[model samples]
Target: MKQKISLITTGGTIASKETKNGMLSSGALSGDELAALCKLPDDIEIRIVDFMKVPSMHMNFHRMLALRDAINKELEDPDVTGVVVTHGTDSLEETAYFLDIVTEDKRPIVVTGSQRSPQEVGTDVYSNLRNSIYAAANPLLENGGVVVVFNERIYSAKYVKKVHASNLQGFESFGYGYLGIIDNDVVSIYQKPLHREFFSVQNEIPRVDIIKCHTGADGLFIDASVAVGAKGIILEGVGRGQVTPQMVSSIQKALDSGTNIVITTSAEEGKVHPAYDYEGSAFDLKERGVILGADYDSKKARIKLAVLLACKNKIKSSDFKY
Candidate 1:
């Protein structure tokens, strides 16, 4: 029997076109239009769903959940081997992680996007989309949670990040590296995540904000987030998750007001550990009721924090350990 794959297009550079003004208009093509331009595999069967046509920046909690539902709906058919989602590269990692956490199926959920529009020279649109379809149909990727296929490389949604603005190799999994690569339409596996996590999003995703810590930085952002009724805050601290002394007061204030605050490192590698006892050190913040964010970046931490807040049970520091 031929493998069946579900291809859902949500609009991104892969579907974008060059506008009359010479700027790229994102998501200009429908799903069928984009697929028609690509040379898809003849051995496999593909099902297309033109889910949405918008830039990645326009993706919000409602749409993310809706996308998850759409994927779940497609998976109801046992004949479907896996799924591929075309997205914008700008916020691709965030949406990938969001799907990783909430998607209920073990079959591969491969998310992909191109850095250049289809009309551009030396474009990666065709190759990336074609490779993603193969990756989605491959059984080796099953039970691995969500994965992002870009520049012929497959990345775990948990660690992938958009590292470049316009390069074809726009996504990377620093420290851990990519899970695998797709070469010549064949998918190869190098490794897989040791574990996958899922959370039931029973409530509306709450307001989670990320505040970056810099030299002489204060708690203005934290204060603003709390005033606006943010349920969680992620502190993108520097070097082992140390914030400026000035931001400590506002962090404590947010914690006192029952806002979930997590401290994450700005470094590409290394988890936030409480090694020092300074005023704004990880140890100090941990003692003051801040959860260590491990190695997650600010955007990823924000997504997980929001999902956890929306899920059942009281949130705990142990919840972010994975």
Candidate 2:
């Protein structure tokens, strides 16, 4: 029997080509172009879902919701073994992490992107896409949430971060490292993400804002975010998730305004711990109703907070079971 796979195409460097003016991210490639590039095995039956062909920075909650729905739709077909999403590297990690929390564990879902456009030399598009196919087709993570495949490394979406500005090794799984690796000639698995929590899609996804805490942040962004109907806020703070004194007041105001606040470390690799006792310390923030983001980065924390706020009554901290 053929290995049935559903491939979703959302434009990125993978589907880009050089134009006279500049490298364009558009419908430069899709089904046929990928088929030609990967030359997938004869026994693998690939079905393409051309959702969008735009850069990843343009990916928002609405588009991500649509993508989520698309993946769910594909899983409805018992014949489809797994799903693969080709996305832009810019916001790919955020999207993957979002999908990880909301997508019910059913079938494998692999997301991959390239650092360089296909028109550029040393492009990793075809290689990453091919390896992603290998991951989706195999049963490695069949009882899945979401995984990011790049530079032959397989990372759990929950922990993956795009660490480098421009490199084939753009991704890092932080403390967890990669779950596995894959190449054209080989496939390997060392570990897998052990937990997943899902939420029901809401009619309207809530607005959540992220503010990076800096030395002189005066809480303007926090007040502005709350003013703009933000249901939640994520504060990427300094060491051990400490914010400036000025930010603490605005954060308290946000919490009083019924907005959920989550604190994360801007450092990228460690968990948010309540160690400091100063005015803007995690201890102070937590006492003021801010939630600790644990090991989650700011982007992923925003995703979690949004989903939780979207389904407020239905989910609890225990639901995440962190």
Candidate 3:
């Protein structure tokens, strides 16, 4: 009764190569090619599925929905013990968490990417790919939701973030560390992220944007987003969800126009708080109908907002709990 691991390849640094100008995720390395370089154990079967050939930076909400659909389709096969996605590191955390929110089956779905291109000296691609498959195959992770694997650490997608720009060590789970670590092809489990509700991937993807607060920031971006028909916006306010006084009116206008807002802080470690009393403080924003981003960074907040908005058909738009 041998089981298989569905290896889905979505182009990223793991499949990139060097060019005359610079490095690009040309996707020359398919899943089969990349897996061929790995010294896989004979106990598990690996099945390659080439889904897309685009860099991670090019990923969007629509593609994420499509990716979720593809993974869900594979889960229909009982023989598929687990799944691995080779992606680019740029937006790997976002994609991982989005899938985490939408995937319901709970069998381990692990995403991995390399900081350096596959052609680089000492590229981390091989180890990342191998570990991803190992993590996916491990029965202990059968219900672990979605996670990112790199540098031997297993990070829950909800808590993970890219900590370094160009390090082989791609991400960290912030205050939560990692769910577990894998050593010598062995995975040890200690804990899992605080579980959140998993929404079914919806039929249509919507426009959700993140607007960062800067000095003298006007609410112009919010106005612009609303003007362009954005379904939701994640306001990355200055520390503790504080925005300038000038931006409050813009935020209000967007809210009045029926655009949902989630307030997030620039600080990395804490949840958005309504501590200050100023015009654009989280307190003020909440009073004006903005949702507080609980421990979610701007990117993650945006992802959640999109999911809730996209699945509005089944989940009443007004009854969005998160």
Candidate 4:
């Protein structure tokens, strides 16, 4: 029997087309158009779903939820083996991670995007999408949760990040590396996440913001976020998660106002640890009810926090220990 896979397209560079002005129009091509350009596997039956046509930056929580619903709808089919989502590289990691947390299905949900437009020379649009479909249908990835397939590598959504601006090798998982790779149309698996998490979120995703810390940074942004009624804030701190002393007051005030704040390190690798006693150190922040994000990039932390809040989960320090 031929393996059946659902190809859900949300647009990205892979679906972009060159405009008259010599600039690329993101998501200019439809799902069927993009799929038609690729020499997809003949052994697999592909079902194309044109969900949306927009740039990655245009993606928001509401749309993400809608995409999740659409994917889940496809999964309801018993013959469908898995799913492959073509997205823009800009926000692909966040969307992938969001699906990873909310999608409870054991079948793989593979997200992929190309850095170059499909019309460009040396574009990766064909290979990435093709590899993703194979990876999605692979039985070894059945319980591995959502994965990002790009440039032949399969990365866990939890750890993957876009590392380069325009390189074909745009996505990377940093310290953790990739789960496996697809070579010559063959899907190979070397590892899988030991644990998976799913949150059943029925409500709208709450407002979540990410604030980057720098030298002499103050609490103004934090206060503003709180004033705007943000449900969660991710603090991208430096070194072992240390913010400027001036920012601590605003962070504390936000906490007082019931804003869930997670402190994540900006470093490529390493967990946020309470290592110092300074006013804005991770230790001090944790003492004041801040959650330490365990090696999660700020964007991923923001996605998780928003999902957790949407699920009405009580924010806790231990919540980030995935």
Candidate 5:
């Protein structure tokens, strides 16, 4: 019998078309329409599910939860072997990480998106979609958790990032490196992420904001974030997560005022080292009870924080294991 794969569509550049006004119009194609372009083997049974038809830049926490629900529904079917998500590249990494953290299933949940539109001469939608389907059908991918396969590279959901602006090979893993690669129909394996089951929110939603630190930056943004009733904030600081003196004061004030703060590096790779000079900005901020975001980027860090905060009332800080 052929292996069964479910293709869930969440609009991105792959499903967008160029309009007369020279702008990209999304939802130009349906799930079945894109699936028709792929050439599949006889041993593969592919099914299309149209989940969302908006650009990934417009995707939010609620939409992510919807996608999770869709995946869970499909997984409940005994015949489904794996799942593939067609997403926009803008926030693809963030959604992938969210799924990796919240999803309990061990089946492969692969996310793919195209950098170029289907109307382009060298559009990569066909190849990317084909490869995504192929990856989904492979048995070895079952235990890998959530991953993003693009530009012929396979990256873990938590570490994959969109680095290039318009290149076909825009996604790459940062510091920890990719889990493995797909070469000549073979899915090789390397490092696997630690399987930590984090709880998801069942009730209220949490709002998170990202604050970047640059030279001569002040506490204005932080003050405004707190005033706006933000539940949590992610600080994208310079190397090793160092912020300006003014921003440091703002972070401390925010923590003092009952807001949660997560510190992550603005750099592409490496973890945030809080052991650096205690007199510096990072140390001062850490002393105020700010949580270390480790190697998570600002976007992923924000998502993680939002999910945690949603369940804050039920799960205590000690139960908060990320």
Candidate 6:
């Protein structure tokens, strides 16, 4: 039986081209153009849908909701075995995480994009697009949640990180490593994410921001964020999620003011532990009622916070399942 895959194009470097003025212009290619860039098996059917033409940096909450709607609509069709979304790398992780948290269906939703533009030499678009299709088509990927395939590495949507500037293998999932990889036309599974659930957006755009703590960094940013009425804040603390004295006081104040504060480690991998020497900054902040962000990076943490804030009234800490 032939497997049908819907290739949803949200413009990124993969679909961008250099204009006469040498500026990178996006959405220059149609779905048919992208379909022709890859080689596929005869038993696999491909359909393309252009969801947006903006770069990943331009991606926001509203666009994410629209993409979710598109995927949900396609999932309704029995023939659509899987979905592939080509998005810009800048915000690929954010979009992937959003989909993983919101969408309930297990049908493989693989998001991928090229590090190098299609016009550049040794572009990775063809292979990434090909492997994403394979990953999406494989039945093993079912119920695995959102998966991102780029530069021969497959990452769990919730754990993946874009660490490098312009490298082909830029996407990585720090301590957890990759969930699996696609090799020899085979999609193999190594590990599964510990948590998974479906969250509802409900059209509310919640404001969540991240505050990175460094030496001599005052609480000005934190105050500004709160002043602008941020519902949630993710504090990217030092190693093992430690903040300075000043920042700690700011976080404590934020929490006291009824704002949700999630503390996450700036380390590439590992979850935040409140047990490590709480006598100083760590202990003070923990006492102030800040929630630990676990292993989520600042970017993913922001998305998780935003999604949670959107469902704030309808969800509680225990019911805050994601």
TM-score of each candidate?
A: 0.99, 0.94, 0.94, 0.99, 0.93, 0.94
Best by lDDT: 1
How far off is residue 293 in model 1, in Å? 0.4
Identify the superior model by lDDT, candidate 1 or candidate 3: 1
Give the C-alpha lDDT of model 1.
0.94
CA-only RMSD, every prediction:
0.7, 1.8, 2.2, 0.8, 2.1, 2.0
Worst 10 residues of 6 by lDDT: 313-322
Candidate 6 stretches with Cα past 4 Å from truth are: 276-280, 314-322
Give residue 245's lDDT in candidate 1 (0 to 100).
Answer: 97
lDDT of model 4 at position 146: 98
Q: Summarize candidate 5's per-residue lDDT along 1-322 as a digit string, tens digits.
A: 8889999999999898889999997767788877776565456888889888998889988898999999999999989989999999999999998888778888888999999888788988887877777787777777777989897677888778889989988988766777777776567767777765555668666778999989889889999999999989888988887888767778878888888888888888776767676543566666777777777789888877888878764323333234
Candidate 3 lDDT for residue 267: 86
Residue-level lDDT tens digits of model 3 in 1-322? 6668998999987887678788574566777777777676567788889899888889987888789889989999988989999888889999999999898986889999888776788988878887888899988887778989998999988879998999887698777789888888788989865555688754576888999899988978888899999988988987778888999888888888788888888887877777888778889988888887867889988888888887773323233333
Off by over 4 Å in 2: 313-321
Candidate 4: stretches off by over 4 Å: none
Q: What is the lDDT of residue 113 in candidate 6?
A: 92
**lDDT against true structure, model 4:** 0.93
Q: Mind giving the per-residue lDDT tens digits that candidate 4 earns over 1-322?
A: 9999999999888999998999999998999999889999999999999999999999999899999999999999989999999999999999999999998999989999999988888999999999999998899999999999999999999999988999998988889989999999898999999989999998888899999999999999999999998999999999999999999889999988889999999999899998899899999999999999989999999999999998885887767878
- The number of clashing residue pairs in each candidate reads 0, 0, 0, 0, 0, 0
Per-residue lDDT of candidate 1, residues 69-93 (tens digit) = 9999999999999999999999999
TM-score quality measure for candidate 3: 0.94
Give the range of the ten consecutive residues with the poorest summed lDDT in model 4. 312-321
- Looking at candidate 1, the ten consecutive residues that score lowest on lDDT are 312-321
| Clash pairs, model 5 backbone | none
Q: Which residue pairs show collisions in model 6? A: none
